[model samples]
Target: MAWMYLVIGGLMEVLWAIGLKYSDGFSHPLISVLTIIGIVTSFYFFSRALKYLPVGTAYAIFTGLGAAGTAIIGMVYLGESISYIKLFFILLLISSIVGLKLNAKVEA
Candidate 1:
């Protein structure tokens, strides 16, 4: 359950990040509002996950998921540059996140 919350939070983090891009420097009213909601919602979920997960491990995975998801979305949806080096690091970051999850000591 905590992991689920963490994943949701991470996904929302990705969403808000992309939202920021589409918000046109917060000039687009609807996108900007949605982005603000995303920010609050993501933090809500992240706070829920912190109840059962270590701060360091949860934070690392949370930010890692956000980073990886945003990068992938940028390339696929936003037509950003894709390079071998970028792919390599994204994979590395993902693997590291999984490793942290595997070794994490859940409090409940």
Candidate 2:
């Protein structure tokens, strides 16, 4: 359950990140509001996740997900260039996240 919260929180982080780009430095009122909401929700979920998961592991995974998701979204929707090297590093980040999860000592 904590892992779920962490993953969801990470996704929310991605959402807010993209929202920020669209918010035009908060000039777009609605987008800025929604982005703020996403940011709040992301933190809420992170707190919920911290109830069970180790702080370091959880935070690393959370930021990994957010960074990777944001990068992918930028490449796909925001006209960012897609380079093989960039993709390779993204894959490395994903692999590291998975490795951390596998090595985590989950509290029963």
Candidate 3:
């Protein structure tokens, strides 16, 4: 359950990150509102996960997921450049995330 919350939070982190790109420095009214909402909602779920998960592991995974997700989305949907180096690093980050998850023991 806590892992589920963490995943949701990480996805929401992706949303808010994309939202930031579309928000245009907060000058775009509707996107800015949605981005703010995304930010709050992401934090809510992340905090829920923190209640049960190791903070160090959870936070590393959270930010790592966000960074990797955002990078992928940018390349796929936002016309951002894709390169082999980026792909390699994204894979590395994902590997590290899994490593952390496996090593961290739940409090239960």
Measured against the true structure, the TM-scores of the candidates, in listed sequence, are 0.97, 0.96, 0.97
Q: Residue-wise lDDT of candidate 1 within 1-108, one digit each (tens)?
A: 999999999999999999998899999999999999999999999999999999999999999999999999999988999999999999999999999999999996
lDDT of 2 by residue, 1-108 (tens): 989999999999999999999999999999999999999999999999998889999999999999999999999988999999999999999999999999987666
Q: Which portions of model 2 miss their true places by more than 4 Å?
A: none
Q: Who is ahead in lDDT, 1 or 3?
A: 1
Q: How far is candidate 3 from the true structure (C-alpha RMSD, Å)?
A: 0.7
- The TM-score between candidate 1 and the true structure equals 0.97
* Candidate No. with top lDDT: 1
* Ten contiguous residues with the weakest lDDT in model 1: 71-80
Tens digits of per-residue lDDT for model 3, 1-108? 889889999999999999998998999999999999999999899999999999999999999989999999999999999999999999999999999999988776
Model 3, position 82, has a per-residue lDDT of 93
